[model samples]
Target: MLLAALVATTALTACGLPRSGPNRNELLAGVEQTAGAPFAIPVDDNVARITAYEPPLTFPAAFRNAGVLGPDTINAGDTLGLTIYENVNEGLLAGQGQNFAVLDTVQVDGAGFIFVPYAGRIRAAGNTPEALRQIITAQLETQTPEPQVQVRRLAGDGATVAIMGDVGGQGVYPIERPTRTLAAMLARAGGISNEPETALVTVIRGNTEGTAWLNDLYTDPSLDIALRDGDRIVVKQDDRTYIALGATGGQSRIPFGKPVVSALDAIAQAGGLNTNLADPRGVFIMRNESPEIANALLGRNDLVGAQRIVYIIDLTQPNGMFFAREFLIRDGDTVYVTQAPYVQWQKTLSAITGPVGTAGSVNNALN
Candidate 1:
């Protein structure tokens, strides 16, 4: 009798407390009494009215202000084709009629200068082809009377941005068109090697640099802005992930397969909740929202200090699934499904039966 009573008490204690001490219910109950309760809001029809945390979908101002794609200015490493015409009778290079017309192909050097017979080394960088022609003509007037000059760009020195990293083709692509955009260039370089959701597109323009998810860039037209000269574009795999814990089918840090992962998809990716052990009414997604957004959503300044939010979803009702589909899951989010209250009791009952069965076996052995 004493052994049976002791086993029963132990079983009841096991039902009351979890292995790690407190269960989700106890933690939430304590939170309610001490603090004004975490921002526990149910995912429902009213949820649509509130602004929830979501991935950034808009392009940065630095990208939008990157200017439209247009013709590239003369830069170093460009090959130039020059034709100079001068009067035959009194010209420097004009020994005779038509012979005065001379064609010279010169390449601009590192100092942004091109060489002409009479003009010596003239600044060519930062000037248009027409602008460079005028400069040559002005310099020739001193040596020859009424000199006419025409400048043509034979070939560019491949003045293009390097599209490296996770791309189909990692090479230097020439910026041939003025209206060349980042998206257009990526297509030329064989698009991204990884899927849009798993790629991170980083842009380095001069000293300023920024990055955006490839999925966001693909969906938002505004993010497909123009690319500047010498811009470095790199596509890398996304490493940030979120954890799925508690009674979910898979408890691990799952990588976001895409830029914007919806709550329903996140749950599915986690292998769904453990049907037998999961509590349908205790589904939760824990994350921290900025104080500003939290305040705006709750419409109260007093709770502005609260950044940690436990968004609850009760899957017992059909409408709950609808809300789950709309809920957006951010990177670093934690999806936790509590164990069913009855599951705990079942475990305790099993523990009690094991001891009773052992005691009965010992009594039979002694008899």
Candidate 2:
């Protein structure tokens, strides 16, 4: 009878047990598809395969591997200067006293073609000034004897790139010989005004857009793509952040203190774990990973959409500290530390023995 009473009393003490979060065992046991359970992975050295791709600060293929290109291609809206020299015996474009006719400030129409007096309407865009010069000479030779022609391209709105945000200068700059590439154009604009580590460089080219870390423009050779006419570049300051929860010393949305933050760094930034309440063996980082990166991490291709993943870092295991230091903490990740297993037992014991001791003290006083 006493054993039954003790069991019932102990079970009652455990009812509705308060917890900061699920312990290691409960977290592992709670995986159910119907309940929308997240996949729990143990952090280790094996995760290094996809480490660099976690935050995915890289330019797309469209902005890679392009060699240095010359900026001489004519486009619509460019201004041109033309000079025509005709034979003195019979000058068609030039008057009898003048041997040459100068036509300046000629604008290429919206259809990428320019109209010359004797050459008629000819396509100018997609052709260099020298190429257009030869076409004009060929057209004038039919009517004028020994027609000599020269075409010069002037600085105009057609060959320019607009740079803005976090740069030393925010304006549209012409793409001349020195400012043909992205690196050169950035220098022409006075470079990035923010910290290189946390800055982002995004390029918008027509319908395509790509972005990378500002440092990558110099570090990675492939990322310094050639600038095209009408390209728009923007440099943005870092705004990525993460959240800390559970038994950590502090719980809040914490900014990534640096450009790159490891798991150890994030834990320290969150004021370290709560020694009295935290279970070091059950530290977790919860995140929603993209399908592409999730596939690479999980070694499967069937998964789609943002995957809910909870990564555990057991500090008590061998080399666990090393793994934690190596693992990177991405933006929006939740750092959680479950409560120690013995904490519940201590609470239950205090709850069951407290009233009994009070009643005994009262009985002794009355006797």
Candidate 3:
């Protein structure tokens, strides 16, 4: 009898156990309440600014600017101006011409290196016109006594950076001048597709990527970075899309370029959630895995990856205001407001009554 009583007690405890934490769907719906809450903006506004420097200025020690030009960025079928400095024992004179004597005009081959009369193959691929001229001038002094050599890049056949993504015109922009800034290239590409205030512009240099907030660039004077050969500039439109399924009026995509939108702002944008049907206690916010989450998951077990998971924010709590403010929404973010169970029942009843109402109308017409 004692064994039977013990078994019965254990079964009752198991049956009475509290429900496990809410599932993914519930968590996602909860986030809708806190979707637009604002957080304290970072104090370091300079984080998004790009500091510009003039030529001959000390390059950032962290960046590699060895002044050694990279490989064959020059090619044939390109027009070049060759100037020969004739040291006539009287004085040094510089002469510029397109078709100079064999010794004067250096022809560039399919490979970017130029074949000067005396200076065999000097790599001119990534060097600026001025830099190339200096290199050739230095080389000529070795072969000829006081050999005066001048070099000019009349055609651009190498070292080009391709600009695409959210720009009016997408094409390969030649790295003509050595000191081309990101802003200049963007202008050449017909500017950004969206408003500069809301766009997110990034410069992909080799393997490293740098992000800049377009709005900051417009207001802050320091954020424009210089562009290098082979650099890629990508401009992305701000996506602030949210769904108001539960107690909000009119769900739709919010136009871009609004100020930092907080949960309160989002709710207001959604016509101040339908207070009549919304359960304030159940509001929530959801965000996809951030870079930090991805890094943490990679360090942990493989199966429990952070990249595939989403972050849920519960706004029903009083302290949720802090979280809502800090949570930022990025492009392609989706906000969904779940309908309450009672709301669903009401919808179902309305659908059921529609046919009965239609039948009644027909009978009245017949009478």
The segments of candidate 2 whose C-alpha lies over 4 angstroms from its true place after superposition are: 1-36, 47-57, 65-67, 257-260, 275-277, 289-307, 340-367
Candidate 2 least-lDDT 10 residues: 48-57
List the candidates' TM-scores in order: 0.82, 0.78, 0.54
For model 3, residues 1-367, the per-residue Cα lDDT tens digits are 9778656755554444333234335554543454443211121113111111112212233223323223323544445677666555332333343223333345555566777656668876646566877787787676556655556656664456688788999988875554256666788888888767768777777787666666665554445555565777788876656544355666666653564665556666677656556655444444444445444433544433224334334456665555555554443444444444455445444554567799999999999
Q: Write the per-residue lDDT of candidate 1 for residues 1-367, one digit (tens) a residue.
A: 9988877787667856554233568746755664655666667766634544554544468887776644647777878888888865656665555546555568888888998888888999878888998999999898887888888888765367888999999988777773388888888888887776678888888777778777666677778878766889988997768888888778899998876677788889989978888887877888787777677666778765548777888887888888888887777888888888787777787777788899999999999
Residue pairs clashing in model 2 are none
Task: Compute the lDDT of residue 139 as modeled in candidate 1.
Answer: 94
Candidate 3 Cα outliers beyond 4 Å, as residue runs: 1-79, 85-112, 125-145, 177-179, 219-223, 252-260, 286-367
Per-model CA lDDT versus the true structure: 0.76, 0.84, 0.54
